[model samples]
Target: MKRIAVLGMPNTGKSTFFNRFTGATASVGNWAGMTVDLMMATLKIGEVTADVIDLPGIYDLRGFSEDEMVVQRFLESTPLHLIIIILNTVQIDRQLSLALQIKRLQIPAILLLNMADEAPKFGVKVNAEKIAQHLEMPVISMSAKYGNQYGKGYDAAIDAIAQTLHQQEHPICVRNISDCAIDDRQLATELDAILQDAVHISTQHSNTLTTRLDRFLLHPILGLPLFFAAMYLMFQVVYTLGTPLQAFLSFGLDWIKVAALEPVFTPFPSFLKGFLIGGLYDGIGTVVAFIPVILLFFFCMAIVEDSGYLARSAFLMDAFMERLGLDGRSFVMSLMGFGCNVPAIMGTRVMRSPGLRMLSMLVIPFSLCSARLNVFIFMTTALFTPQVAPGVLFSLYLFSFAAALVTALLFKGQFPNHDPLVLELPPYRFPTIKQIFVRAWVEVKHFLRWSNQFIIAGVVIIWLLNHLPMDVPPASKQTLSGMIGQAVQPLLQPLGINSQLAIALIFGFVAKEVVLGGLAVIYGASNDAGLGGAIAHQIDWVQAYSFMLFTLLYIPCLSTIAVLKRESKSAKFATLAVVWSIALAWITSFLFYQGARLLGF
Candidate 1:
């Protein structure tokens, strides 16, 4: 199969195009490096089958960020059959520098003018045929988010590649230079000529809603408040408005237990019934109960992203970021970390400075990702009533931001100097309803795919741990996990997390959700009603609060650690993040416990 690599600067809709062509929802965002790692998919254009690889979004090849290095290595080793350089029509001048470098390789390529629809609205027009004549290659104008108008253009590029692969001479070269050396000024002049011929200004409008909103959203005084309010509403909706949906799902699960399982298992022994219904069903059911909240959270994020608010959020955070020895552009990755940290860490390549990039990667783990939020809400609402749950949940998010800020400050003191933040502010437009639904469904599907395998395995593991005994009664403080918990209890005693909870926290290092899984095993096995009922009967509100605090601040899951190791390129940094996070978690949990006790809570 022919190999075609899709290259572009960040936020140019490369991922959206990849998703459209491959039918793969590889996390499309309004920010750069969303596809941090290389993504491959097969696209069949009539008689030709081609392999399309999506490379990391980069600004210039001259820089040496991790994502840029990935692209560099691919260029050096792989014999790319064709290169599709996607350009945002609004930012054509800036994006063409990379195109100039790609052309120097003497490889067949096509200039894909993505987001063509937005160009006209931004008072810019590009003549595709004129651009093709100037560049001496095909130039296709396309809106990848909407249609297949450029299908023929993509085919033409492939045919050009096939025809030129073995040719003795190529059309592209540093023109009028026999020495085979190109100068920066000459490259700029050539680019300006191309833009002059291909690009035209139609008309410009003033006082757009985007500009008026930015006046407040980007203002130093009002920006932070608006940001907090926006996030507050997002969390509140997930918890408050999603409650009925969550409860309805839980009610249905309960009905299945009573109406379907009860009658069929009437003759079974009580232990067997408890094993299947209470241990198995209750353990998995609790985690599943939060699906509605998860979906709602993704839906809300999609709206914010689609509405083009995230870019403005990044712009607002840039100034504050400079104080921390990193650029504000890092906030884009940190914000994306809310949905998933893997891509967010990868997105750090957009920072341009290696020092700032590493610093951003270090703190990304501190972001309260959606996965951890699941554990947070489940434990918080179960321990405290729903009326006070939003406040408690909000506090956890605040704590996470605080942790990130403190870490950034500490890192800043150590490093001392870094690059200033430079970012592009794209013109905002109202996102289509169809686009929002598509993005939401894609995220929901991604969540289900990951949760189904790992969480199911987690449920079964907890069942074994809870069921297996070492000559100790189920309710005895001398049971297997209890003994293990006691052995480590002293270390966490200062933090007010008891032996059992500490043991659960240790298991959580493997995966944050496993803390709840561990709790299910310990509490579910002891009581017939399951983990929720057992916790309600045994643990007081203060201990529950301590548990939530520890869960929020403790070590991230193994997957996040692996991504950190890869992004930071130093085992020491990754280990430091893990150790410091745990220590911080212990300190915070301890303070909350003692303070709550002193306040007579």
Candidate 2:
């Protein structure tokens, strides 16, 4: 197959462009380092089928960092013929330099001034024909993300690619080694001179829309607080809107259990009824009810991201997070973890250092992910007043970062990411309804795909443990989970954790969303009349908060652990992750409970 390599500097939408043509869902983010590996897919251009490879984004073709090395090695090993280099038209000042360097390679190239649609809004204009003449290559103005949803400018790009690939019969590189060894200083000066005539910008405008907004959004004092405020708002909205939807979902599930399911299972044996209807059905249904919260959280994030504010947040984050031995870009990974930790772990591939990538992988699990979000929603709403519920849930998010920062610092000496993180602030764009909904739909679909299987499997396992070895009345002391929780109760007593919560935690290890279902199964409460009230009566607010803290800090869900193992390529590191987190959860919960009691709470 003809090999076409998509190359560009970080955050130019290379992966986005690649996904458009290849129809592959390679992770695309608003920040840098999204494509850490060579993601290849089959592209059939008109009639010829070629192999499309999406290379890691880099500033210079010269190998500098781990990602750069990966790019260099792939270029050397793979016989590539066409290079599709994407450039952000608004930031041509920085991006054009990379294109100039690629020009030196004398490869068969097609340059895309992507996101050109946003250039006019930012008071910048690019003459693609002029630039093409200056660089002696094909330059096309287009937008990859816009193309991602609609065929606005996408069809033209595909035609250009197909025509270019068909015409370029020679190999990608034909120049001698000396071509890239030219004087760097003189080359940059010459390149700037060439681009001067090809691009136009208004210098009279000091306060563009982006700069005007950044005054507050990226202020030295307010940036961090605003970021937190944004986070708090996201959760507040999630809880506020999600709770009612959660109640609605619970109603549907209760109807199914009593009216739809119970009738069918009426003739079954006690063990089967208890295991399937009450245990499995009730357990899975409880977690499913919280899907609205998950959906809302992702929808809000999608809007924030599409508006280009998320990249600015990453730029702002680089300043404060540097103290933790991580750059602000790590903030993106941490937030992605809120959706799911597996992709976030894979996202560490964007960090340049092997050690730094590992540090990022470690920091992510501590982020309060959606799986744990369900458990928090249940505990906070069940335990606290409406006025206090958002506060409690929001505080847990704060603690998530608190724990993550401490974890990053403790591992600072062990894993240091020395290279400074470089991120370009993308021009702020007005988010369109279509873009927002598209993003929401994709996330909702992913949430269901990534979660449904895990949820069902975890719920079924909890059902078995509650019923097997004896036909114990569901959640009785003789159950297997009960015996195990009893054995561990003394260890957890310091944190005011009871036997039921202990068993729930054990099942939660499979997946945190299961904790609520585990509660319903163990407490013998129906979905509509389930453990929410029981938990409120069983434990005081102090213990409830303490229990929430313990849940927040305990080990990563099984899927995260498995990914950590795979990414770190060591069982020992994964084992360390499990041990460290559980230890922290225990100690943190213990101190909180004991101190709260002493303070007369």
Candidate 3:
């Protein structure tokens, strides 16, 4: 297998091309730094197997950022037979500077003029064959989005690489290296000549509705309001559209418990039946049934991303982000982190400044991810009636943003020289439905897989914690949970949470969702109640609201911290996230509880 490396400036569709070539969708977006980790896929090009490594997006090779170092190390250490340099055809001069640097390494490389379709619309064109003749390597002009246009050309490029591999000679040709120095005059003259000989200009209608909308969307005053409105609508859909589906799943699960499990377990003892019905049916089944809501959220996010509105969001927030000690680009990663923190942390590679990347990684975990959304919904819907739940949900999301902002400011104060945000805006295109579905399916599959493990294990643990006394008489309020809750009750009393809810908050340190699972088990033992009745009858709404606040501000999950350690390479930073999050959660919950009490809640 030959190793093929994909390199490009940020947002030049390197990942889009990589996905097309390797049949792997590793999150392509108009925004930069979409692929942070090394994504490798084996593809059969004709009869030969090709291993493709999609590296992080970068502008210049000379940088101290971790992502640039990752790319540099890969190039220096790996035995790459071919480098497919993806360049934006519209920005030829800037793109070719990096191409020239790669050629200096004397490696066989193919210059892929990606986004060829946009060149003419941008009043530029390139003659690929002429450029190839000058550079002494194959040049391919193709749209990665429309693969059929360059399917044969891609194969031919690979065939050319395979044919030349046996001949132990570098294919790069450099004449008068001094002339290609890319200084002011020389670079301009060469670009002019190159454009004169091998390019064409055509006036084409490039009417973009996205650009027109951006006039309002990118307006400083209007942009934030619009963003909040759009986000509010998104959340509303997650609840409004998702409610029927959630209800359907609940009804189905209830039917299975009564119609299926009860009949099958008729001969079993009552405890065994309760274990099967309560633990499996009500516990794991409820978690799994929320797959539709998760998928719906993913699908909506994918559409917004593919339509290129997400980039505008970043552009819109640049000024506000600057004040918070984060670049506008950090918002993109944080937004992705809301879907899942793993990829969001990984997405930090697009930030060129090391300080900003680390800061973004530190704060991104505070973004409430979709995994925590189910817990939020369960808790909020149970505590507040449906009429008041939306406000509670909005407050939780706002708290996440506030926590992240404060964390970023703290880091910025510590490291004062972080680089400011600079990004290229790509022309917006309507995302293909197939692409949206594929990405959504990938996320849904991942969530289901995690739910199967963590949720199941959590439910079982809660069950064991509640039931291990082996049919002893039901414990009173003075039992284990009660004792622990009472011990911590003073610490959380200012937050309006009672001893039982306080105990669940302590258990939430294990997993955010476990807070709900713990409550279900505790209340289940008390009155044979499920999650619904547990929250409705036992926990006060004030306590429930305070619990949500704590959950929002509390330490990130173990996996999130692990990613932070790996990404930041600083145990101190990870520890800071945990400590500060806990402190903030306590402080916030305290204020909420005391304030609510004052307001006579």
Candidate 4:
């Protein structure tokens, strides 16, 4: 198989082009920093399968940025037949610079004028022939956003790959490096000259549709409120609409447990039944049932993201984010962390600087991941009034953002000179069904893939610990899990958390959703009563709030810790994070509990 490396500057629809060619659901965002990792897949053009690699987006081949380093390292290691460069036709003048730099390298390549449909809206026209003639390479104008045109574009793109591969010895005429420094102003001027005669931009004296929408959505008076409202609606969807579907799924899983699996377990030994049915099956079931809520969230997020509203969101937030010494683009990662922290952590790869990525890693945990959301939903519904549940949930989210800001502020000096937000907001494109479903599916799969193993292992471990000491009552003080929880109970006294809650926290360290499952086991509450109802018997509203606060602030799950360890590649850093979060969780919750008591709550 031949090889083609897809390279481009950020927000040029490179990932979209790759996705179209390979049918891989690499994330397609309207802003920069979306594709942070190397994506490789097989692209079949007719009968030939070519190995296609989508490299990290780069502004120049200067090897200064983290993503540039990623591209540099990969290129040095891999042998390639053709270099496919994706360019945003709407940003042709700025986008052509990278192409010019690559052309100087004398590599066999083709320039894909991606997102061509947006060219007209931007009042820009690309003369592909002129670009090709001057650059001495094939140039094809295409739009990945338009599904109808996507097929033709993709087909032509694949054919271009084939053509480039065939011309292996016949390299595109290389431009001389001469006295020009790679990223110098002279080089940029020269690159601009290559397109001066090829491209024309008409004056947009009046406002366009996007400009019209921005008037209301990004209006100074309404933007912040609108942003908060969008966030509120996000949480509301998970709780309001997701609840009935979650209940239905939970009911199905429970039926399978009792009506199907329990009978099969009746003849088995007690230990085996507990291990299989109670430990493995029930544990996996508890987490899997929440898949609906996770899916719903990603679906909503994808719509907002692909619609280009997220960029405006970042624009509105840039001022505040700069105050915290972080880029507003990191806000995207923060919001993503709400769905799942692993990818959110991974998403930090798009940050160009080490300081910014580190800052994002430290801050993302405060974003209230979906795993934590399960516990939040259960506990909030259990203890708070329905009239106030949404508000309570929203407050938790608000607190998360607050915590992240505080975290960023405290650590800002360590990461001095963090990258400023220079996001380019793409035009609002009504997301095709393909775009929405594909993006949502990618996130859902990522959640499941990252979570399933941890869920199963964590569940089984809890079951073993809770069931040990053969004749002892389940989750009693004498049991292994109970003894551990008891040992730590003294530390939690000020915050009013009991042994069961303590044990749940200890295991919740494994996975946050397990807090509910562990509660069900410790409280000996049947699935019929609900984890929330089961827990409502044990703790009052004040204790519940303290409990929720602790859960929110505590150490992230083992999986997150593992990823942090790997990403930061610093054992000490990861250890410090664990210790700091525990201390923070304890102190914050203690303060909330004590302060509330003082106020007569």
Candidate 5:
């Protein structure tokens, strides 16, 4: 199969272009740093099956950012049949320099001017044929975002690929060092000539929508407060809409357990039946019930991200972030961490400096990931009134940021970053319903995949621990789980975490989503008394708050640790993350629990 690579500067709509053919919704955020790693998918161009690799966005071939290194390494190591370099039509004058650099490599290539529909509005005009003639390569002007569907651009792109493949020359096997070593000044002069011949921008045209929006959204005094209010409102919508659906799903799942599965297990022995129903059904079902909530949160986040406000938020936070020895890009990684920390850790590759990347790795794991969101939502609803539950959840999110800030402050001296922030603010666009749904479904599928990989196994293990020895009452002090939990209970006692909760925490090391499953198994939550009821009966609001705090501050899941080890390339650094998080969690929860107790809570 032929190999093609799609490359571009950030926010060029490259991922959306890739998705047009693959039918896979790889993250399509209207921001820089979204594509931190290479994404590969199969492409078919008229009976030709080729592998298409979407590379991380980079500004310059010689740039020192880890993402630039990624692109450099791929080109140096991997042979390629073609390179599809995309440039935003509005930014073509500046982006064409990257095209010139790639041209010097002597690789077979095509140039795609994405977002062509918005060019005229920005008072930009691109002469594709002129560019093609000047560069001796095919240049196509098309909107990747809108042209892929019901538009001629999609068909034109496919046909262009098919023809190019049929007429292709030898594949690129090695770097053309002499050609690539051309003087930068010469390349700049050539780039300017090409732009003068093929591109035009009217001085009268400006993106009024972006200008007006940024005036308010990026204001120094009001920007931060507005961002916070928007986030709080988003959380409110997710909870208010998702909670009822979650309850309905939970009820339906319980009905299945009692009405369907119970009859199937009736012929088995009592112990076997208990394992099937309580260990497997109840435990897994409890976690599954929250799928609606997860989907809602992802959906809301997708709209915010695709509408292009996420990048603005990063810019607004840059000043505060720089004071902590980081920058706006690191803040972007932290916000993305709210979805999942493993990818966020990998996303740190966007940092140009090693010190900044390490600092970001230390801070991102503290973001309140969706898994922890599941746990906090469950606890707050069970322990607090509806009127106060949103406040409790919001407070947890605040604590997540607080924890991240403190982590940065504590570790900044060891790892210092002097890299200045350079970020692009894309024009705001209303996200299409199709894009919103696709993005949300993609994330939901990810949650389900993680659940299958970790939560089921965690539930089974927790059940075995509680039911082993075949003599003691389930979850009793003599059982394996109880004994294990008791061993660590002493240390957790000050934080109001009991033996059962201790065991849950141990299981949660596998994945935070499994914490809910472990709790359901430990408590033997049934249709009559659901997990919420069991939890409410087991712990008061204070103990529940303490557990939530610990969960928020402790080491992230094992997958995250593995990514940290791989990305940081240091077992010692990964180990330090674990140790520091545990210490911080213990101390913070201890102080809160002690203070609350003293206040007569």
Candidate 6:
């Protein structure tokens, strides 16, 4: 099959165009390095089928950013039939520079003026045919988000492109950069001539809404407060709305267990029945019940992202972040870390400087991800009253920021970086209902896909460790997990973590999403209520808080560590991520628990 690459600068709707044409659910986010790596999908246009590769967004071919290097390496090494170079129409003046650079490669290419619908609103008009005549290539003006369904405008565009492809005889040949080099002044002169001949602009109504909104949203004094208020409201909605949904889901799963599965297993042996229902059903089901909460959180996050406020949040935090030897982009990665640390770690590829990316990897794992949030909600509901539960949950988030801040400061000396933050503030647009729902659903599916195996395997292992040696009481000190937890209890005692909880922490190393399931298995609880009751009976509120703190700061999951190792390309760096975090976790929790006890809490 012929290969085509979709390439562009950030926020140019390149990925959206790729998704609409190829039907791949590549993550659509409004930030730099969102693509991070190449995403491949198969597409059929007219009578031809081809492989579509979505390359990471980059500003210039010669730029030194990780994403730029990725694009450069791919273009130089891979033979291709065509390159679809997308440019944001509103920013075409500068964006054309990238196209000019690519043209020097002397490869077959198409130029897409993406976000065309928004261009007129910004007082911009482009003559695509005229540009095509000038550049000797096909130029298409399109809003990638529209005509999403099959056999629509986007599909027709692809059909036309395919027809063009059939006219060519051979795969594209790679060209050396040194041979294509042109003087900067000559390139600028050529770009100016093209803009003068093929583009028109009116200044009156350009970006009016964006400028007006930025005044208030990016204000020095009010911007930070507004950002915080928005986040606080987001979490409040996630919890207040998610709690009932979680309870209903828990109830439904329990009903399925007792009403459906219990009868089917009745004829089986007693031990087999107990193993399936208790070890498998209850443990995994408890984690599954938290799905609604996770979905709601992502739903809210999707809105923040699609509405174009995510970039603004990064802008507002940039000044403060710089004081800590980081910048706004790093702050944005930390925010993405709140959703999941593995992808956020991968996102550090957006940074141009290697040291900044390394520093970000070191700090982003400290984010209070939704997986850890599941543990917090479970414990907070069980230990704190409804009136104060949200406060307890919010405190964990604050702790996350504090932890990231300290990590950045302590490690800044090790990884020195001096890159300035450069970010685009896209015009605010109201996201469609379909966009929000699809984004949330995709993320939910992602969480399920990534976590299911870990959750299931961890649950089974914990169950076996607790239930083996049938002569001893289940979860008793005589069992495997019990003896292991006991062996580690002395070390954890200072932080008020007990043997059973210690076992949960050990398994949590596999994945934070498994921690709740591990606890369900360890405590022999059949449901959320039972698990809550069992935990409450075993530990006081103070101990529970200490455990939460430790869980918040400790080592990242196995997936995160692997990504860290791969991204940093160093085993030592990944090992440091593990050791440094656990040390920080121990010191912080010990201080908090001991200090609270001294203050008579």
Error of 1 at 544 (Å): 2.4
Pairs of residues at least 3 apart in sequence or in different chains that clash in candidate 4: none
Task: Give one digit per residue, the lDDT tens place, for model 5 in 1-601.
Answer: 8888889998898877887667773433222233234667776778777878888888888757788877877787678888899889898888998888888787888998888888888999888899988788888888777765535766677778778876774578556444478578988898888888989999899999999999999999999999999999999998899899999998899888878998988999988898889998888888889989999999999888878899998999999999898888888888888888877887787788889999999999999999999999999989999899988999999998999899898889999998888888888887777767777887888778766799889999999999987798898888999899989988999999999889989988889988998999998822247678877887899999999999998978998998888888899999999999999999999999999999999
TM-score of 3: 0.85
What is candidate 6's CA lDDT for residue 519? 89
Model 2 per-residue lDDT tens digits across residues 1-601: 6878899987787766776577654443322333233467776798767877787778777766656666766665555678889988778887887777777776778888888777777678788888889878888888887774543456777788889888877656433434465568976886778668878887764436778899989898988889889888887898899999999999998888888888899899877887787778877788788888888888888878767788887788787788888887788888888888877787776676777788888889998888888888988888888889998999998899899998988997888778778776776776666556656666777666666767676677776776666745555668787788789989998899998888888878887877887787776632235668877777899988888898988999898898899778889999989999999999899999999999999
TM-score of each: 0.88, 0.86, 0.85, 0.90, 0.95, 0.94
Query: What residue runs in model 6 are displaced by over 4 Å at the alpha carbon?
Result: 25-37, 148-156, 173-178, 525-529
Candidate 2 segments exceeding 4 Å error:
1-6, 15-56, 72-83, 100-109, 121-123, 133-137, 145-152, 165-190, 315-317, 353-355, 524-528, 565-572
**CA RMSD of each candidate after superposition:** 4.7, 4.3, 4.9, 4.0, 3.1, 3.2
lDDT score of residue 439 within candidate 2: 60
Q: Top lDDT: which candidate number?
A: 5
Once model 5 is optimally superposed onto the true structure by TM-score, how far is the C-alpha of residue 333 displaced, in angstroms?
0.7
Residue 299 lDDT in candidate 5: 95
- What are the Cα lDDT values of the candidates? 0.73, 0.78, 0.72, 0.77, 0.85, 0.85
Instruction: Kindly report the root-mean-square deviation of model 1 from the true structure over all alpha carbons.
Output: 4.7
Q: Count the backbone clashes (under 3 Å) in each candidate.
A: 1, 2, 0, 0, 0, 0
Task: Report how far off residue 437 is in candidate 3 (Å).
Answer: 1.5
Candidate 3 runs further than 4 Å off = 25-36, 149-196, 200-211, 261-277, 385-387, 449-453, 471-486, 498-504, 513-530
| Candidate that beats the other on TM-score, 3 or 4, i.e. the better one | 4
RMSD of 2: 4.3
TM-score of 6: 0.94
lDDT of 3 by residue, 267-332 (tens): 998777767766555666666656777888898898888777788789887888888778788888
TM-score between candidate 5 and the true structure: 0.95
